[model samples]
Target: MTTALIRPTADLYDSWAAAVNEFDGVHIDGSGLQAPVVPGRVTLDALIRDAAVLADTTVAPPEDRVHNDLYWIVDDREVVGFLSFRHTLNDWLREAGGHIGYAVRPSRRRQGYASAALALALDRAREIGLERVFITCDDDNVASARTIERAGGVLQDISDQTERGHSLLRRYWIAL
Candidate 1:
C-alpha cells in the first residue's frame, strides 16, 4: 500500500465532495469533515477559511474551547481519515477528550490508515514541543485502543463516563 500523507485542505474540495457524499451528506467528526456540497463550492470555501482560522494559535477561543489544528489523512489523494490535535487540554478535555482526536472513514477501517495518521499527528505534536500527549478511546473500542498502543501509548487509567455514552474510557499517554 502506498504511504498516506497529511495535508491541509486546499483545492481538494472536489475530492472531498465525493467523500462527503459517500456518507449521504452527513457531517462526521473530523476537521473539515463531510459537508453538503453546494453549488459554487461556497460551503467548502467557508470550511477552508474556518480551518485556517482554527489553526491560528494567536486567536483565543471562548473560555470553554482550546487551541487546535486540523489535518486530513490522505492516501493517493483521497481522504481516508482526519486528525485533530488539541494544542492543550482544558479541564473537561483532560478528563475526557485529550490532546488528539481522529476518525477514519468506515470504508477505510482496518487498513492501517489510522495508525499511520496518528504517527503523523505525533510528529506535529513533537514539533509543537509537547512533552507528552494524552489520547483516549472507549473501553469497548478495542480497535481504537490497539491503534493507540501501536503508536506507543501507555495505559494510564480507566475513566468512567456513562453519562457521555462512553461507558468507560481507557486513557493513555505517549511520551514525545
Candidate 2:
C-alpha cells in the first residue's frame, strides 16, 4: 500500500518510530526527516511540530524550500519509503537537486520500492499542476537513473559534480 504525506497520526507516528533506527544515519529523499534518529531525541510531538514549521509559509518559505512529504506503506501498517516533492526550486535545486527527491529504508531496499515511489511522486507532481519536473541522481546511481527513466524521465544533461564517490550528476526531466 502507498500513501501520500499527511499529518502523522498516532498510528503513523508509531510506524515511523519503529523504523527510525534503521534509518538513523541515512537520508531518504523527500521524507523531510532529520538524521541521527537518536534514542531519546524523537517524539511524535516533535515530528509533528517540525513538519508544521516546514510547511508553514511564514516559517519555512523564505528559503525557497517548501516541500511536501509522501509516505510509502509496505504492509498493512508500516512506512517503507518517502519522497519529498518541492513546490518550487531554489538555485541549487533548479540546477541539481531537482523538484523531487526520495529514499527507501535500507531494510526495504532492492524490493522495487524506490521505483514505485518515484512513479507515485510523479502523480503527485502532476496533481500540483506541474508540466515537467527535474530529477537528478549521482552518475553512479544506476538504479536511480533507471528509476527516473522508468518514470518517463528523459536525459537533460550531466551536471559537473565532484562528490567523493562520483564526478558527475545525471539529470533528467519528466513531463507530467
Error of 2 at 30 (Å): 2.1
**Model 1 vs truth, CA RMSD:** 3.0
User: For all candidates, what are the clash counts?
Assistant: 0, 3
Which runs of model 1 end up more than 4 angstroms from their true locations? Answer: 2-10, 21-27, 32-43
Q: Write one digit per residue (lDDT tens) for candidate 2, span 64-156.
A: 565544343444567776666776778878877788887767788778877776777778778878999999988888888888898899998
Q: Candidate 2 at residue 105, lDDT?
A: 70
* True-structure lDDT of candidate 1: 0.78
For lDDT, the strongest prediction is 1
In candidate 2, what residue range of length 10 has the lowest lDDT sum? 35-44
State in Å the error of residue 26, model 1: 6.5
In candidate 2, position 14 carries an lDDT of: 56
